[model samples]
Target: MDQTTTARAKGSRKPLWTKDFLITALANLLLFFSFQMLIPTIPIHLSQLGGNNVQVGLVIGIFTISSLLTRPFAGRALDILGRKHVLLVGLTICALTIAGYTYIAAVTLILAARFVHGIGWGLSTTSLGTVIADIIPPERRGEGMGYYGLSNTFAMAIGPLTGLWIMQSYGFSYVLLISTILAILSICSSLFIAYPKPIPPTNRAKSQRFTDRLWERSALLPSSLLLCTAICYGGIVTFITLFGHEAGIPNVGFFFFCNASMVLLVRPITGVLFDRKGPEWVLLPGAAFTITGLLLLSYANSNLSLAIAALCYGVGFGSIQPALQAWTISRAAPDRRGAANGTFFSANDLGIGLGAMVLGAIANWSGSYALMYRFSSTLIIVFLLIYGWSIWSYSLHKKAAH
Candidate 1:
């Protein structure tokens, strides 16, 4: 009956799941599931088409670059246009492009399809992120985002394994067929969601310079941190299959399975921690786990070692990503959530693009995936320094203000 008890009761009653939220989350799961299916297998398909390591990297890089370019416009549109309109358009593009992959026998054609697919990826994901942010009560944003992220986690768990199995048993074209089907299902599920209405731009927002409208300044810090982590992720997803072959391991898909399992275990707990404490509670430890995971991956030569590495990386990745997203959305103005999500994902695309190119070149030059992984892990050191410096500077500013 007292104020503290009353507040706690009300907080506990805040809804995190609703009909629209569930539908959107299901759509996002299918979208990611379709995409994740291609992440590991695409490189192999490209190689079969006579592409080398650098070319494979280029394909991945180009996809992310295209996605990166599309996101700013998509974000602006999500704010000015309605979420449902942008989402459906994006999903339609994705389904079509994924089907196109079935006919791409040449490496050049695959690259072209990937580029187009990335654009759809940018629009749909940005719209989904913004939609979920809008639907979740701010009081439970961290927890809500965590649950939403599980859709991605679940997709990661099975997508690659299923893709690899299909490619081995049926053919690469079958993978494309199934991925296209999943994407179409995503579109169908997305249609059922009751989307939030667009927020009209403020007078100042309308008057802002063109470049200024593309990014949310409040989201930049977390986005930057995310970019550093994503650089390492880019290398892993793109090359892990090849690396497993090089090491004479029979299956690489188990890495994704174990990784997703750990992610599934840690995400909800980390989300609650992030909500109750702060991002620091999760981020610092997450970075350490990621670093350790990459190092383990660098040395891995067998299934057990790979599984260990995957578990560590998954815990770190699952913890850090949702925390950063929640932090970004919580800081941004409600009207600017679309732009904030755009900026956040743009960083992700940029990092992945850069990582693919740079690490691919490294792998090519060194003739060793292990060496490339070692190099990739160092990027997290940069993440930590930036995060630590920000915290230190904030404390200094707080003291000076006092």
Candidate 2:
């Protein structure tokens, strides 16, 4: 083949191993590792740093606030910039942010680190999700996403357990350093991935128009019955860590491990279910399991109780997340998949972030973890009632139109 022909041929050839997928997965694994590593330990860490319950909430809450604030801009920037470049920048920022935590002796400095970490997280996660959507075929997107989510599940599963082990033998700074190293390694892995060139805007500023569409969809999400399922699911996942801490639970690691295990186990099964049966059927049971899991958590203070809660939570989270995503995906056309996901996840993120912030603050004000659980349970019920209204309204509208 001539030089141009040979180059084109090589460019068109698929890799034997799909190295891009692996690299992306490693990056995701690293992101979750640092992101989740402190989950079981951070409350204790803040307490050690002389922070009161409110400050404890502040440290955790600041991260979500910063992350949630950055989502729209992050999504837009990913569209404007190259995914690999953004991914690399995010990984480097993550490494520095995690390392910065080791220097924080005061709660304020710790909160600063968390806020910066949130920015890094926002950029990195947005790029990863969009990149996967860019690479995967529409027909198989759900399956591809299902497998991709396993990266987070596995990392979340391992991070807390490994973090605790390191803290037991080494120290907090050392564990922080380990998290930094994982982040840096993610940057290295990202370097191996080949991102396709940015799609030229056929209509200038189409991304902006897409963003506008997203905001409107978001307004509808909260009142949508199916969305209530997502909202309730979000709150529970965000605050469950606090639940473990209050019980003087020695093994927060084990608690999360059970959660991750269920997530790891359930994704494939749910992927097929979404593929065959569609999203609505899977979502209801998913919400049911999530509610059941949280209730079990409310009742259980021991490790065994915690483990059962995790099992219930794991199944609940695994099923609900994919079902919601697939539902959103099915509702949109291929051209707008990124926008659709941007809209869907923004709601999901808002639910979780707000859950952490508002509920964590409430937990602090109430002066008891048990009260927080009770509060969360009540919110879930409220979510269900709202969701039921949306469903009924839709049914009546369809009947009238027919």
Candidate 3:
């Protein structure tokens, strides 16, 4: 048998963990830990700087806008410029911007720093996804990605809690220092990874139109679905702390802890299910869980209710996200995987950015975070409808082909 077939057979027989995979996963974990540490805390920081909800949303959302804009170009660059160079530069930028947060005395400066940070985020994340895709065995992609996603989950579980505690105990400056250190460590870990050699762009790849280079068509469906889900996620990450205060809860960070814990539990199972069954089986139940969680969260008044909502949302999001990612990668040609990852993440950033801005406005207009969450739940319903339509249309197309 040829090497590809031989590798597949071996992969099927044994687990797909390599030293490179472990190091890469570690790097991803540290990178996300640094990012996640700031997700909930930044709004609080902005609030202390005399920013209102609208300003908070703009500052937070603008980061994703810049990240979103950078992703398309970053994706193309990965295909041309080589992964290590992109990854290191991105990490370095992230570290510097994160450190700059400590010195910012005004919300406007924070906004500018966040925007610059997004560029690094876009570049690093796309490169990481592409690098991991290269390391993973195709036959076991779902499983590998699930395990890989656990790194993010682990970061989510600890990063927010740690950040909030540090902010509460020491101050925001200490939080920035620690986060910057974590990001630097991430860069260090990435240095050890053996990146795959870039495949030289074919003449056709080189001659592709500018617009065509920005996205991969094969990834559109899954990316679209992920975008919808990310909108809801943006609301949670951006406002959950404020919501907790509104509901009279003492500690809001527990919600993230519970949510991430459930994700840690569910991701592996969902990954296996996706490998054995398909995206449909994982996605349908996941959507239901997410919708239910959102509704529950909208009404949550106590820790118990919050925990329940978090668990449901966690199961839904954790399962759906990796499945969509694996689906996106599986559909793309090897040389185009970077672009596919870019498209996938771009959709994510767009959704989050839009969600933050729109939902912030809703929260301000209604003067109720609870009402905002109720509205957020509706978007997932849209996700369900779209997915249902896609499935129906796909079935019809298959029947016609047959």
Candidate 4:
């Protein structure tokens, strides 16, 4: 509309090409790398701490929950605090907490560290998504988002496996130290990105309180949709390694390997669809496939079932994330994009974190992993009900307006 608005939208309007964008993107990649590096080591650490399976699950779930709670505040803070500062603070915290793992022999301290680490994750992740959105054009959004998602995709594809290898070969402390060093490097690279100084109490002058403007009522369908996807995500991210252990296959790598393989196969197509069509086309069907995959996972007894479930879950999850991201982009006002990302992801973290907690409790109480799947599938039905209600209510409003 106006020149100022246009300039802000197109500011540094380049993706992966500019040092500003590249460094910003790479910062996220590195954060995820440092984060995932701890994944394999956690179970090992828990084993040494003499905790049971439930404790391990709680450790993982707390990370998500802590992250989840911070998102709304982070989103609002990003609008108030400025992206680079938030990113820097988050990265610094990540480095410290990651390194802290070496000295934390007590299980309580370890869990506390994870909880604090989540705050950093929420800040960093929300800022990264918002900053990248600032750089990429709407026209190539799907493609740009695809490439952007690659940061996590690559990390997901590689981090845990690599971490596991190093842990087995060197030791947990070395892996934590290596992750600490890389995190420090990420913080340094973050300083390279140029940001216009904020004038006042503004999230880089995008100042708005998240609670005041959250699409709490309007975004029910999309938010519910995101929740469903998150529940499935929780189960996989939280328990797949245990699943491997239970099945006597023990490939912690394959959990994400299968996820990455399918994401690689399907994300480009979903990205194109996201840019061309709207989210509805991508999301509703994606939910079905995700549900099917979880159901299949409930019954999985062999490698074939595992791979099949992964493929299905990957297709489902890979499709949902960008679509929801685009929807958040579409729904928010120009100034509130960061807050929107926060709300969407807060919901995401809540589902994953809380779902894992609930499911973990189920697994703990029942003394069976299969029960986790059954419960997860039951939650899928709850997601469907939420989705159906959301769509119906929106339709009624639309018809009334007409």
lDDT of each: 0.88, 0.68, 0.88, 0.74
Q: lDDT tens string, model 4, 334-379?
A: 5566677788888788778766767878889988777787678766
Candidate 1 global TM-score: 0.89
If both were scored by TM-score, which would come out higher, candidate 2 or candidate 4? 4
Candidate 3 per-residue lDDT, tens place, 119-212, comes to: 9999999999999988888766778899999998898788877899999999999899999999999999999999889888778777889889
Clash pairs, candidate 3, are: none
Clashing pairs in 4: 79-203, 80-202, 80-203
Q: Cα deviation of 180 in candidate 2 (Å)?
A: 1.6
- TM-score: the better of candidates 2 and 3: 3
Worst 10 contiguous positions by lDDT, candidate 3? 1-10
> What TM-score goes with each of the models?
0.89, 0.78, 0.89, 0.84
Once fitted onto the true fold, the runs of candidate 1 whose alpha carbons sit more than 4 angstroms away are 1-13, 40-57, 102-107, 245-250, 363-368
Write model 2 residue lDDT over 197-298, tens digit each, in one string: 765444534645654634325324432433444445555566655666777666655766788888888887876665555554555676677778777876
**Candidate 4, lDDT over the whole model:** 0.74
Deviation of model 1 at 367, angstroms: 5.2
Residue pairs clashing, model 1: none
